[model samples]
Each structure stands twice: as C-alpha cells, then as structure tokens.
Target: MKIVVSGQMLKYQVRNSSTSRSSPSSYGTASPSSSSSNGSQHDVTLLTTSRSNSLVSLNSLDSSGPEGDWGVLKVYTSDIRQCTDYKTIRVSTKTTARNVIEMVLTKFKLTCRDPNLFELWMELTTKAEGKPVKTILRLENDAKPLELQRCHPAGMSRFLLHMNATGTLVRVYDHNICAASNYKSLMLSSLTNCEEAIDLILAQNRKSREESANYGLFLTTPEAEAQIPPEVSIVSVYVLSQPQHKIVIRPLDSL
Candidate 1:
C-alpha cells in the first residue's frame, strides 16, 4: 500500500523518532479504516510552537504603527538661565593687580573690552594713639601703570586688568563709572577697605557655594567654569577717572 505524508508530518515524525524511544507496546498498528481516514485529513500538527514568538511578531508591527513618528522626532527646550554668584579669592598688590582683576572678572561673569580701564591704588594706613591712619596711593604714580585692555574674541566679550607687581592695593574701574550701572554700583562704596573688599568677595564666593549646595544654580556641576558665547566679543576696557578702577564693554554674546 502507498502512504503520503506532508512536510510538517514528515518533520514531526523524524523529530519524534530521534528524541523519543518508541516501545512496541506503545505503538499499535492503526486499523485500515482509521489509517485511510487519517490520510484523508489535510490538517498537520506543528512540531514546534511558542506563544512568545507570536508575541514578538505582534510587538514588531505595533512599534512601526502610525505613532512611529513620535519616536523619530525629539523636542528640546532652551537651558534655563543660571544664577551665578562668585568664586575664588584673589589678593592684589602692585604686581598682581592685573592677575587679580582677570581672576575676579572671570569669576563674576564680566567681560573685557578695548580701551579698557585698569588702575591700582593702595590705602596706606598707620596706627595712631588709639585709632588708625589711612591714605590712598596710585600704583601708576609710583611705577609704570599696568596694562589694562579689552579683549574682543569671536562670540565673547572680556576685559583684562593686569599688573605685574608684588602685593599691593588695587581697585577696578569700568566704562560704566556712575552709580547707576549694576556692576559699578554693586562694587562701589560696598568695598571701602582691603579687609572689606576681601570679605565682600569671599562673601560672594560663599553665597555661590551655598547656592550650589542647595542646587539653586540649576547646573549639574557647580564648579564648572562659564564659557563665553561665540557671537559676542570684547569691545573696550579702559581705566576711568577713578584712581584704581577699570571698565570694559563687549557684545551681548559675551555673557
């Protein structure tokens, strides 16, 4: 007699034969009618099946559905404005005036400008019977004035206040000398003495540190330095009439 088997049936038969031992008692010969009936049936049982494979196929179709565009496009918002306080402690004598100025400007988010103002002065003082004696001495009067200039780089504005000297008293002046300018007004009378100036700068630094500790600066790293934007550059930085002050201006991008 002739027997016909489908591919699936043949595969199943081969797999079962290889993986399982069939005992004579377990295998009974089918009746002639039953064998003929099974041969007439077209349905074939799968040898291997899994619900997980079917689920994977369904998930793939869902991933590429109509909403797929949402996944492809990303939306971003501008970074929030950062609140910067201050950092670093700089001591300026005659020689280090420029260095101190640069350090302070960088710390305080100030930029350098051309024709920049840079001046250095000392508040000389001597102790009297019960009080103190004080006087102001301009470094320029005693020696060659330090080089104060504005630096205008592509996309950034900066002012450079430099003096190559030993420890001496120094004060910064900027283009906006009047009390109206935020930067000028804030630094004026606010700092009357060396100790006061140092204390003020340190206070700002401490405030910054405290803000960072509280996560008020909205920055991932508080100690990270600020980079000047490329669009703006320094315009000018020069010493104003003020004896120990400097001023500078730059493009808005410098901020």
Candidate 2:
C-alpha cells in the first residue's frame, strides 16, 4: 500500500503480504515511559506479514523521529520482493556533515578506515521549528570501510616515489623546458648531430654495458624531458662516491 508521511513529504509503498506480527510496543509510542506508566508493557516485533506490515512501516517512521517539524523519510517496501530488501532514505538537515556521516556509518556498522574515501557533502536548511535540520550525508556505492596502515618515514618516501612514478606526467613548457634552456639546448644539439654525448660520457667512465646497470645512462624522451624546468636544464652533473664527498662536473661542451 502507498504510505505518504506528512510534515516531511516522505512517502513509502509496502506490499500487503509482507506484513509480519509485531508487539504493540514495537509499534513505537511517542513516550514509552508514559505508556508503561499505565501498567502496559510493549514487546519488539517485526512486520513482515500482511497483518503487521503497516505497523512495521509506522514503527520505522517513529524510530526516525516524532511526528512534527521533521520526520524520517518514508521507506518504500512494496517494490521490494524480499523481506530483507530495503532502500536508503536520503536525509537532509542542518547538522554537520561529519556528524551525519558518523551517524550513517554507525547505523551501517561501518568504520572510517579510509580517510580519502570518507568524504561527506552536506546541505543546510532551516526547519519549520526554526531549528537547524540535521545534515544529510550521502554514500556513493563505491564508499566502503578502508583500513589505512601507518607508514614509517622511509616507507612514506618510498610510497611518494611510487606515487610520483605512477602518476600522470604533465609537461609544462615554462616549468619544464623554458627554464632549463642550457640543458635543453645541449640535449637537442646532441640529438640533431647524432652525437652520443651522454653515451660517450658513460663509456669514458667504463660504465657502458649492454644490459642496463643501476648506474647506466639512459635516454629521456622529449615528453619526459619537457617536465624538467628551464632553470634546471643546465648540463651539470654531480657524482657521489666514498668519503661522502660530491664532485661537480660539466659537459664537455661546457668546457
């Protein structure tokens, strides 16, 4: 049957055959204490059969909030073929996004394991009672609990390197080539002349090998080269060896 909840414009449609037997207390009274003061006890029940489906829907609404300024969004169960089938109702209020997200996570028995994916968006609205409504947080289908592992300093650096290596490389003309005029000029000139300047330098140091060694020289593509800023494109090389001393060497052309 179609159920239109007033005060909040919430609506739901539940199948009549799915109603189950439920206790009067499970129907959800405004004040349980007051109801019990009359020497009445209520029992919790589920509405899965036709007889109690209406009560179940009403209880669901009651559990959301009292009937007044703001009420819980109605749940549509008529289209649901199975008893366990339920749809999420979007809640919009003035509550903080963080709090709303936390509440939703708690309701779903979920924990924030991935801060990156735990993003929350909220909209603010004034309630009829002149009070701020609670924030409505939405969860994307991809959102799930993520466990983040703490990384040590060394591990963090390695992770950063991996991220950089795998990330898309954007070639900024000014930042990559214009600033490093001297280096670009040298590399370009070498390319034009078919001169293996870099390779020759490696050969002079007896570092040349058919198999790429850890210290072997390699060619950087123009696209890769473009990522180097012009200011850093100068043909200057640095060597670090034993004794913790560094030696600065310039290209042969520089001499």
Candidate 3:
C-alpha cells in the first residue's frame, strides 16, 4: 500500500513506447495497433481552436465543481508496454460503456468473455487540465448512456484494458471500494524510492478500487505552503471529446 501523491511534476513526457507516435489534438486518435487493428472509419479533423475546452468540464466527474454521482475512471493493463494492475473506477453518469465493459469483465474474473468481442477505448481530452493524453472512441457495441456520459473526463483516473486481438496488454482490476478520509491522490512530480513510490501509487490507484469519496487524483494538490513552481508531470492525462467521438471494430464472429 504505497501511496505518496504530493503535488505534481514530470513536466509532461510519456512514451515508454506504445509504439510512440500520436498526435492530432482536441483529444482523439485510436489505431495504436491495439491488437491486430480491424475497425477503421472514424474520422475527425478539428484543431482549429478558437474556443472549445469545457463540455461542462468535459462532462464532469468531480473536477471539484459540477460532476457528481459517481465519475471516476483510470484503468491500465499492459503486456508488452509493461504497466500493470492499476484501477480506479466509479461508474454512473448513467453507466453503460457496455455496463462499464461488463464492469471490466467482471473485475477480471473474465466474466466468460464475448462481451461483443470487447472494446471500450474511450480516451479523449482537451479541457486543458494540461493536455497530452489521447485515445479516441472505439466503443461501438451499442454504447450510449448519453454516449457514455458524453465521453467523460474532467481530470485524473484514466482508462485502458485491451486484450481483444491478442496484442497482449492484459492486467485489469477494479473492485471500486475507496475510502480512508476520502482517498485517491498520488500525483508526484518526481519521486525516487520506496519501490518507485509503490509503482506510482499502485500505478495510480487500486487498493481495492474504492471511490465513494475523495473524488479523484486528490484534485491536484499543489498548495506547497509557499515556494511555488512545481506542477507538471502527471505522466499524461487528457479527456474532452465529442467530434461525435466514434470508433468501432466489430467483426470477429468466428470464435
């Protein structure tokens, strides 16, 4: 249980290499070969930036102001890229990313697979809480709880759990239970020891997936008494999409 979340500081730099290369902002882009690549026909071209970065705080999820009634997301499962068992889920913006992907395949019991060949890649961002994270909608399995809370993302607690086409990346866990004086906050700008800060605070969450309180990523600490200048390096996080956000790859009916 190693959780150290202080302020923030990594000065933005993520590319441990998921094949690197990703661009085209307004937070949307999927085709990182996340397992054999089959669905393509999702097109969106909007970087014209004049004013568009607060879809009610990107559909709100405790950005500390609007979103409420459960909105926490951040899951990671890596096979070759090498990150593991990191979860922070708290559904209900009316739920249904296929019931949160069958609640992450029944919180990893495999829920007997075939949840329509699995696909819930809804990663998009640009409410500029410091942009960088990106992964467009790849949800299509009749997903629409108002299009999954309008592809929500206000800040912290991200998502990803691909094991579909055997690209490997599998390691999901989220029983959603949070507590301990409103927990969830581990945003260190730079930490060194304690087993790499307990795998970056359990790789950003999951000491039994609990979020009945703290409202996520400690809402960006940064009070530091007085000596300012130390806020950057949240590894990478972004979410704000609705260029109609849609990407689907469903065609594996053959076992």
Candidate 4:
C-alpha cells in the first residue's frame, strides 16, 4: 500500500531487499536480502507507521486532553512511515489493548476473524547518536491505553498495532552438542516464509549467513519431526505443527 505523508510518498510491502529503506523514525532496518527458495513472496510489511495526512476526522479525539474516562489514542499500522499514517480513536478507561486493535482493524477496513492475530505495542522513543531509537513492548490484553498513557511523559511513547505470528511457538536450538537448555523462541509473523524466518533466526542468533549456508530448519511435533524446506510458508508449517511443535536448526552434517 502507498500513502502520502509530509508531502512524501511512502510505499509499504513485505520487503526482502535493501532497496527500500525505512525512514529514520522507523523502528528497525528493512529486510536485508531477497534470496528466497520460494519463488513467490508474500506482501506483508512486519512493522510500519501511519498517522499523518489521515482522511479520518479528528473532531473528538485530542492528544492534549486531560486524563479521564475518555481519551484519544493514535494507532499506527505497517503501511506507512512514522507518524504519517494513523487512525485516531476515542478510547475510554475501560478500553483494553485488544479493544484498540478491533477499532483499528474496523476503521482501517481490515478483515480478520481472530482479533488475537494482532497485538498492540508501546513504542518508546529515545535519542541515541543524535537519532531517534525506538523500543517496542507488547501490551497485555487487559492493559488500558488511556490509563497507561498518563503514566508516561508526553511525546515519549505511542501505540503501534502489529500482526502476531499465528503459527505455533517454535523454540530453536543449536546442534545437539549445545545444552538443551539453550534455545531461542522464534515467534515471527505468519506472513514470514521459511526463508525469511531463517534469515531472521540467523540475525537474532548473531550468526553469519555466509557461514551457516548448510543449516536447515527442522520442525518437531508430537506426532513426528521433519526438516522443512526453505520454500515453505510459516502458515503452512503451522498447519502441520501441534502445540508442542518446535523448530530446530542444525547443520546438514548434524542431521
């Protein structure tokens, strides 16, 4: 999707190339590579911002309003850059993070049967090296946005709505030589394919891609465990995975 913010055009898509760099205000760097075993890639941007140049009326919600039963909350999606594309909603003290998500989806005309498929996060901005750095914290379902806002200083935080990986929670471990206790939980978006997941996993583990070319993803379920191909979608893997499913990464020699 494309949107105009601050007289500049911003395009949002599930990116695997470095050609498209996010604005300085964005949380993280864009995807680094486009190499995927899967011939096709899904169109899903993991994180994006939208707030400026909004078509929605801003009559009722005001950011400067005092703490009360009702307040305004700005919600950003993954289609545009920071504070450029957003939907403003009037929230109450009774409003939960899940409630905000439903409002965002409905206002944005997005269709999703499961509200749990999405999550609301708090974006804390701090200055580092003369640039803004963002820290994201997932909000609990019962957390109140309006009330929470009062706890923080002004302009220090904002809310962002993101899609949660619908797949089973997979714990990735090193080869058998490593202790079983050493594992990293991989909970990426369902839109992430196996290839992107692999890159993301390697990045998280701080392993060099050039050195890990022989590594593969293995999915383990209560019924069985098997090595997954790079072409597989995370959604497809989820279908085959049970609640106890996990993804184990190992070199080809260790398999």
TM-scores for all candidates: the values are 0.20, 0.16, 0.21, 0.39
lDDT of 2 by residue, 1-255 (tens): 112222222111112233232211222222111111222222111121121233223322322233222313222122212232322334432222343444444444433111122333211122223322221113222221110001112111100000001111111111121233222112221111112333223333344423112221222443332111222322222111233322222332322
Error at 103, model 2, angstroms:
1.6
Q: Among these predicted structures, which one has the highest lDDT?
A: 4
Residue 126 Cα positional deviation in candidate 1, in Å, after optimal superposition: 1.3
Q: Candidate 4, which segments miss by more than 4 Å at Cα?
A: 1-68, 79-84, 127-133, 167-255
Report the Cα RMSD per candidate.
37.4, 25.0, 20.8, 18.4
Give the runs in model 1 whose Cα sits over 4 Å from its true position: 1-95, 141-255
Top TM-score hit: 4
Give the lowest summed-lDDT range of ten residues in model 1.
71-80
For model 1, residues 82-177, the per-residue Cα lDDT tens digits are 232223242312323444444444554553211123333322223333222222222332231121111112212111122222222233322222
Write candidate 4's Cα lDDT for 126-219 as tens digits: 4434334444556777667776676568887787776643545555665442443477665555555666666656655556656556777788
TM-score of 4: 0.39
Ranking, TM-score, top scorer first: 4, 3, 1, 2
Q: How far is candidate 4 from the true structure (C-alpha RMSD, Å)?
A: 18.4
- Sorted on lDDT, best first, the list reads 4, 3, 1, 2
Comparing 2 and 3 on TM-score, the stronger one: 3
Question: What lDDT does each candidate get?
Answer: 0.25, 0.24, 0.34, 0.58
lDDT of 1 at 198: 27
